[model samples]
Target: MGKTTGFLEYDRIEESYLPVDKRLKNYKEFVIGINDSQAKIQGARCMDCGTPFCNNGCPVNNIIPDFNDLVYRQDWRAAIEVLHSTNNFPEFTGRICPAPCEAACTLGINDDPIGIKSIEHAIIDRAWEEGWVAPKPAEHKTGRKVAVVGAGPAGLAAAQQLARAGHDVTLFEKNDRVGGLLRYGIPDFKLEKSHIDRRVEQLKAEGVTIRTSVLVAGKDGLGKDSKVTNWANETVAPDALLADFDAVLLTGGSEQSRDLPVPGRELSGVHFAMEFLPQQNKVNAGDRLKGQIRADGKHVIVIGGGDTGSDCVGTSNRHGAQSVTQFELLPMPPEHENKPLVWPYWPIKLRTSSSHEEGCTREFAIATKEFIGEKGKLTGVKTVRLEWKDGKMSEVPGSEQILKADLVLLAMGFVSPVQSVLKAFGVDTDPRGNARASTDFSGGYATNVPKLFAAGDIRRGQSLVVWAIREGRQAARAVDEFLMGYSELPR
Candidate 1:
């Protein structure tokens, strides 16, 4: 608590964004971070709550009050150290995480929550500018080797931790570059790729070997026509890794996108959100793609009301689409949640992202009945209105309608990880198809197979990047203990 009365004296200051017109023309981060003074004011708003619910609210359990106090005191270097102590990559979460920590802030019960995410953004950016972020290589080699499959947040975190623990760690990625979904799934307008690049360099400096474009699979391999993105030029067998490395950790993402199997789903114009999103990201990265799915001059219909759907709307607007419409199967949530009933926890409420604000017509409680098309191409979508009562949904009589659409992007969330990869290593899986593992302190993250571990989306299903980092760190500790009979690495 830098200032006891600061919460009463300061109002929340939100981060600003570039003008929509100017930002729509390019794929770059548009958020204008708050200045140091504004960040200090925001930090000062952190109440000296006894419980510090914000810490528990954060997936990685960041020391929120400590960082807030540091930022309030203008201790930029210390602020970043505290941030990095919990989060391996604050830049990613600061940009994209929904900031549940703010929702659970003590001040939020009666007033606006402290702007923790903005303060974090300022701290990390300032640290980088001041050259405070640098490699902390291990003091001595442990003489052990570890193999981490997948180069996403979880894998990256695990590799960094294990390498810093003095173990030889090699991170394998199927894509030509690192960052599983972050590399290709998210639009650059939200998160720039340079952040991931610098971290990649840091990992190398820390003595973690990064092998991109390398697929580690079993005899079956990811099928030739798998929708999961793979750019691996070399394939390594699971057996080879088991023999070469002391332990193997699976941190791959949940790449199995849920599909709408309605009539005309086979239409050429209908595609998964993953199929359309990665292309634009690659193009933004200067990779020219022929026949890339574009929304230009077309009536675009994005099904699903989640973040992925919002991303489609933004990308479609950037592509200069004639019109962009988003559909949500569930009824719209309240504009505001009942704070008294849901305090100190994530509450359900309507969320309009920057992409939605840019331009999008959102339809809620609507379901697509069928895809209407001709000549093996999509033309329109048939829909029905829904009425919900007592947690059950029923179609409204005679509410069917046909919406004109040239491109239909299914932005529904993923169902599970690519089961093929889990099966390749003969690891047990939960009913949800995620790798089965426990998080108990005794041998946590260990799979049924000895010496094999799982974390992040591969183990817990699709989740926030912060959660991925937490799982990665804990999994690294588990692996360290398994290797050396005990570990000192923080979980």
Candidate 2:
């Protein structure tokens, strides 16, 4: 509402990226955020629509209009204030979130949506540069202890909120470092580790105790060769936490990677995206990884046409692969969605990520039939074309083919959280294997077990980071209300 005719006067300005050649040499963030003036112009494009669908569209329900107005008025400090009021970590979401808020923007019905994500990135980056982001430690300590398992965004948010609410919160992470997935799963080329480090320091300053490389599991303990990444040297029993902590929260990510069970899946070259991704992140963080999976000088085939697959393509390119190809089981979506029919909601459409643009041969409507290999090493992949009709898929006759693939990375999404953790806590789980819990205003996020709560992927399955933050904040409020009679923390 800062400028009524601004939408008509301004066109959307997209964030720029560093050249692929220059960026591929190193694992660092390449996104060039928009300048303040460009952000202001983008903010001006926010129409004064009576209904702010963007607010509802955003997982954390960020005050979009208020931030946009603040940016438009060149009030960077206030803009970040509004942004932080809702999102505990805007830097994370601003960099990686797909910006569902933009899809639901009123201006997007016909015109380009306002560059909300870019504005957010600019605001937060500016705030950090101006030293506006600092710790807000609780004024008084509550005589209660809380245990938060998993140091990902959800766990981080919950710990921050609970600590600010004057509770003694100890955040546990299975990995050697914090940031469950963000610390390892995501490539450093997309999000630098420094962001997570600073936030870790902020949490420490806020009086949240962080315990990394500590695994809290059931009596049996997490078995060997578990696909879930665990670098914990110390293992704490669930019973110990229940006895020491007044409340426990499970905010771990969905780490159960869906596998392709076709023949030759046992091939040495075939690996889960998680298996390959985390190694690179560790390497980027200066950890020495012997026999780390690399795509160098190999024909790489990444299965699954999702963000993870795109990430594989990018990483492969960075590894100097001979060739990179991506496969999608489903037919390609339309280049553009029908706005009239899908307004104010996420729509199905073709999305080409920066990784895809770098260099990738994308194959749609194709399924891998089998992995062809010799000497226990992958050599190629057999595939079949699919024809879809009425939501059903049938193989196309005589459409089989074999493609050279020295390394095959299965980038299909996660199915559920590691069951062992939930089992350790004696928490109930949904049919999908996610921890079963409700989001009702009263006793929300409470698991079947008393004094135990679940949020983020552990409860809702794999989702966007923004959704994880929302669940964490809401779960914190729920825990606060459970500890005290009521909670002043925002839900």
Local distance difference test, per candidate?
Answer: 0.93, 0.94
What's each prediction's TM-score? 0.99, 0.99
Instruction: Identify the runs in model 1 with alpha carbons over 4 angstroms from their true place.
Output: none
Candidate 2 local distance difference test against the native: 0.94
Model 2 root-mean-square deviation: 0.9
Question: Where's the lowest-lDDT run of ten residues in candidate 1?
Answer: 218-227
**RMSD per model, one decimal:** 0.9, 0.9
Model 1, residue pairs in steric clash = none
What is the C-alpha lDDT profile of model 2 across 8-83, one tens digit per residue? 9999999999998899898889999999889889988988899999999999999999999999999999999999
What is candidate 1's local distance difference test score?
0.93
